[model samples]
Target: MSDLVARTGRLQQRYEAGCRLVAGCIPFRYRSSDETDVNSEKVVEVLMINSTSGPGLLFPKGGWENDETVEEAAVREAIEEAGVKGDLMDFIGYYHFKSKTHQDEFSPEGLCRAAMFALFVKEELDSWPEQARL
Candidate 1:
């Protein structure tokens, strides 16, 4: 199968219950700076991917697959969507969001829950899935 098709397949695999469950990460890196203090000397920059289906930047995220743990799923999403590999840091928290297109019989409000993680990016691909990033 084509890369795009495989990616779309992974992203579109929702739970049969219609309850949207997802995994994602906030990928970030620290750059050396001229500042003095150890804490302040590193400039932190977070990676944001251009939304393929809508406007604005977004963290790499997608549907949770039955075959993988939440952390694994989050890491997979980051690699596929942002082309970044990183250490999975602390479990940040869960976020509940709503989308008009996501509404269904099980989730009338189109509500979705995502388990978010903090990923300290170690490597960035020279060429990622073709899309804008910030």
Candidate 2:
């Protein structure tokens, strides 16, 4: 079994202005168009996971815990949800959204603010915490 484990619960979750603070990453990789060509065109591919709630794909994300920096949380989410490890490149931006399921005392309206980043995927694990869910 892998030593990796996904964090759970909202015990350390951060909230601000009735919005649950979240962090996530857009994992991507460069693929060579032709292996034979010395200067082959590189194709960019973004990684996405199957959403547990419905019929859609989503980037890895979760609550931004108080114990970790937003960048740490984003990287953690990628490993937990996508079973991939990578270098977090750039800060994409913050996005706001609402989710009834995420409603809690801190976020009565389920309002969420997600800080997203670009991650250059470096490793893909054959066994990860959430691999069974994939």
Candidate 3:
């Protein structure tokens, strides 16, 4: 797991150094899980975006400031890269790399493992922002 994280850091470095083009997104969904005591479920569509590769593109996110949480960083990234705005209800969960959906790009430090951070937010729009095209 450490190796995978290291690789992700390298990926960030590449994006910063003008080496990599692909950018990741922290897409979030809103769910009924927040309304506890009912044990019921609700489904809704959410929006996300991958950053652009060339000029006018925003920098890819990796590490955050010492006082911030990853959730905050993710939200900030979404706004900068996707131009979407919303509030995080809470952390939904994290998907480990063991899942079949895992994927990672090459990193200089080592190989990488991919993971998804699921967030539950309020009032997420289904439309993709114009900035999301890249």
Candidate 4:
């Protein structure tokens, strides 16, 4: 038999589900991995939603909703917010943007693990749906 199974890791620490949170739909484009764009280029208006909780950078995201994948939700958000025809290109690596508030509201050090994916647009999207930040 072949080993064809996905692996998942459990949190190092336990916490109430109520304390957990998710924030996604941060529009990120492919930069060829060759060009170094350390500095952000607001040229493109990204879709970001502030947490209703307020105080700090938080967006509307969840682990699973009605069996919908994160990528699906992201794409749906982009289309609805930016009106862009985007297609999933590839999966990007994860990163840990550590912060005190993040640890408190989200989880421990690596609690707020973000799912970064690249979106290949069929064409230039309006990008600016309505003064949305990128």
Candidate 5:
């Protein structure tokens, strides 16, 4: 079987010479309601993927590569990790996080700045990269 894990060998870890940048999205879908139009203003439930290596839920995310825009990286991460595709609705916010396992030559502290977006889920795939393991 093919590996479902998202590959990050080509991704860019640094925003510049010293800054670490990451991109991610919060996938969400509107719950079924009496309204005929699915796009109608309804209650929304965020899609949270369970982590195999961690206890808490997580949104799909990864390094923002130098070859792609931030939006593209965010969408790609969502498909690879969450097995979902959607329209990015809006920019949620930026978060700074520290990782113990990510320390490298670029950043000794493993400090990272993440760009987060709100994704309006349009389709949920039956199979995706790492879908089985995730």
Candidate 6:
């Protein structure tokens, strides 16, 4: 069994102006289009995790807690959800969305503002907190 465990609950989650703060990243890697080609073009491949509630895939993301910076939260979510670790490359941008299904005490309206980043994946773990679900 994996020793890693994903964070749960929103007791320390950050919120502002009634919007829950989230942090996430697009985990990517570069692959050579042709292994035999000396000058093969590099292709960008993104890593996505299976959604627990449905059939779609999604980037790793979760609540922005008070104890950690946005970058830390993003990286943590990547490790927890996608079982990948890497160097956080660039700040993509903030995305705003609403989720009635996610409504909670910290975010009564389920409004969320997610800070997104670009992560260059360095390692893929054999097992992670959510690997059983996958």
TM-score winner:
2
TM-score of each model, paired residue for residue = 0.77, 0.95, 0.37, 0.39, 0.82, 0.94
lDDT string for model 4 (19-110, tens) is 33232344544443334666644344344544434454443233323345667755654454444556765666544443343454335453
Q: Mind giving the per-residue lDDT tens digits that candidate 3 earns over 1-134?
A: 11111122332332223222222234556467557646677657566444344344322233333344556555555554454556545444432112122223433333222223444444433543343356
What do the candidate models score in CA lDDT, each in turn? Answer: 0.77, 0.91, 0.40, 0.44, 0.80, 0.91
Clashing pairs in 6: none
For residues 1-134, write the lDDT of model 1, one tens digit per residue. Answer: 11432245434445544568889999999987865566657789999988766788889988777778999989988887888889999999988777546666656777788899999999987645543433
Tens-digit lDDT string for candidate 2 (1-134): 55898888889999998999999999999988997886999999999999777788989999999899999999999998998998999999999988747788899899999999999999998878887786
Question: Which residue runs of candidate 6 sit more than 4 Å off their true CA positions?
Answer: none
| Candidate 2 stretches greater than 4 Å from native | none
Q: After aligning candidate 5 to the native by TM-score, how far in Å is the CA of 132 from where it should be?
A: 3.8
TM-score of 5: 0.82
Q: Over 4 Å off in model 4, which ranges?
A: 1-66, 98-111, 123-134
| Model 3 residue 104 distance off true place after TM-score fit, in angstroms | 16
Q: Is candidate 1 or candidate 5 better by lDDT?
A: 5
Colliding pairs, model 3: none
In terms of TM-score, which candidate is stronger, 1 or 2? 2
The lowest-lDDT stretch of 10 consecutive residues in candidate 4 is 1-10
lDDT of 6 by residue, 1-134 (tens): 56899988889999999999999999999989997896999999999888887778878888999999999999999999999999999999999988646888867889999999999999999988878888
- The CA lDDT at 31 in model 5 is 76
